[model samples]
Target: MKWPLSKKMETSLLACAIHKGEKLTNYCTDHNHLCCSKCVELNHRRCLQVTPLPLAATGKSTDFKNLSVSTENALSQLKYYETYQKDRMKSLKVSYKEHESLIVDGLRLEIMSFLLQCETSTVNRTHEHMQYTVIDMREKIKYLLADFEKSTIKEKKEELNLKQAPLKVVTNSCIRLHYELFHLHVAIPKVLDKPELSFIASTKCLENIQQSDIFIKENFSNKVFTVNGKSVHNVKMPSDSFTCDILAVCALPNGQVLVADRFNVKVKLLNQLYRVVSHLDVKQKQLGMCLITPSEVAVAGHDEVQFITVSHSQLAKGRKLKLQYRCCGIAHHQGDLYICSPTALYKFTLSGKLVCRLFEDTSADYTVWKCAVSPTGDRLYISSWYKHKLLTLARDGTLLATYTDPALLSPHGLHVTPAGQVLVCGWLSSTVLQVGWEGQSKLATLATMEDGVRWPRSVCYSSTTSSIIVGQWEDDTILVFRVE
Candidate 1:
């Protein structure tokens, strides 16, 4: 049935058959088509849920503002990958030139005269391969530029203003671009696949070239981390294991977890299955623990930092460095140790040399508790247990930003994922807050006490299993959650 045409319909151009001269007024849900009164009578007579076009537009479709923000964020990440690949290409070019020089230097005068033809052929092949890789990288850069252009300011503005914007189409296009960008990030490094170069006077040389393994793992959670089931996977330290407060937790690449018991002066290592594999006794009480290497760890507490080596689930004390003040929480990034005390942050070399006092917040309620460094080693995230806030700092210790929210109460432990998402344990709130790398946005409540996270004091993330481990202060139990 046709009603009086609305002002908009009257002013808009006709979108249906000329013979009927009818305006499209209804949307047929079953047939998925827009229809005029005559078309509906002829073709959609039996269709169910034939809704008026204006009524169909009443409900919200997609969040244009959030979409624009997400698109811009993805673009920024792509730009980071592009810059990284370009740096790799530069290094590859330098190495290629070095190898070429080595070949020329190694060729003797008489041997060069006899093997000139073979040398020229080998050099030409090597040079051609390098040039090919360079060209491939350039093409990848162009592709990323094109993808970024789609999310430009003008395009975003136009999309936001559209009355019937194709959100599904735009979303699908973005998903496809995200997949391609992730794979490109993995493949760009291998374009200049490392090739062994050697020079032989009489015989031909065989150079083995192997592409590095590529792993494309993308976290689309937007930091909305959560516990999957009614119960969190938790393991408690046995009575015989140790009687102490669990102050710090660190997850190793091999799926083992290292926990520092502050009162008992012990460090315990848990296997992949959350089983206690071994424990090490330290002379000083331990408050913080961090993995220095796959086989080594740095333990800090009571005004001293100790390095311990691990092998076959066994721990052996190696080196000890004395600090002027007590150490509470620790993190290692690029051969440097970041230690957080009650009032100050310190940076030190792995060899025990003091680097500099990064910063000190002497405010009565703003005690810095734990620290974590982003994978890029650019931003440092610290939890303020007393102040109930999270602080983001640059590598130079300059305060970048501070994050405080009602959900974030007495923040304790801090961990930054390789993806650059920041995770903070809210001790008083009994919840974990998943934050953005910039400390400007709170993504989600990663977990809560109801989910078996009780007074979580320490937190760590494992890339190997995509799991997060939480160590509680009062409780002896440790909780683990698998994240996507």
Candidate 2:
């Protein structure tokens, strides 16, 4: 379990951490000294020689000769955590792009609505003015007509003996004619606006889909990329729907596909027709395996995972059993789920019963992002997101062999093909790796960056066609490699 960094090597990498009074300086200029000249004299009076930090950093002068298991584990943990965060950012980018269209559509509608309201206000004002003018004209006409009725035409004739006053009366017939043809005094709303809109739908919330491009900075699959490739199927989703980061993929016997959506905390089921017939939602910190079944699901929690029914109204509440510490992956064997962690993989039954517990070496810095059981269910292959190698462990936690070659860059997502080929994903560099049993032989290639397979998650083989179904994590697509 311990790394083989020699004492000589350890000493070469060591640098001094100096402390004086209450101050601490890391890798300072002075060798193993506590502080400045004054503090060194004060704190190192009882010790041996005090020198500059550069001297301690040198291979010959350092006090420590080797790195501990704990130190290596801490380093591995930090590296994977950074990688995980980076992947999240990539996912955010995809999500932002998906919302662009929706934003445009919503803005257009809002402008039209505003303009419609302005036209409606104009029409109301014009109608009010016309009504007042009509009312005033009618009142004047009525008064004149009444005055004419009170005095006869003869009286008017006598009063106007010197000058005949022409009789004038406003009639209903005149008013009717005026009302029949009227000019608009106020602007009527004719512009397109909210009120004029025949149909208007409220905008919905935007959903984002992104895949973080986090992997090893260096890559080495250039030579074997072609032989490993398969046909790509970018299983498309809706632009408006929320997208899930595909961390894991497994094919069912009926051609149904099971996906581990690490971010959305759900496991989805897709039939051969690509229909999502069933789904399970688990409310846990599922950075790795947010898995699913027909009626229930097993999800990874921080320290432990929960086995819960999919029918639960709330996701986190139905987690039937609290699992081991820091659960990362789930493997279904016979009647139990193997809970994977850095230090251990535990097996538990459906009713929250503890069936067995498998422990790995505590000293080894192993980070298991995904685990897969062999077809026979006797072997377990674990993929490391940070380590330089992959591990083959027995069901009872025995180390079968290690796969550490120069070809892989950040191994992740393990799967055992029905034909017994061990499949691994090269995270940073976009490659699918294959190895024979016992890590004795390489399967030439599976899929690589040159073949447009980047950051693949897992690979499944179909017996019907002898094709490899690869889940490309970063691209949010599936590439199927047919056996040629």
Among these predictions, the greatest lDDT belongs to: 1
> Model 1, 277-364: lDDT tens per residue?
7888788877778888888889888799999888898878988998887888889888989989888889999887889999899985
RMSD of 1: 23.3
Clashing pairs in 1: none
lDDT tens digits by residue: candidate 2, 221-310:
111223444455544444314445666666654355666565555566655654555666656645454334644455566766555443
The whole-model lDDT of each prediction reads: 0.66, 0.50
User: TM-score per candidate, in order?
Assistant: 0.55, 0.46
Runs in model 1 deviating more than 4 A are 1-223, 230-244
Best by TM-score: 1
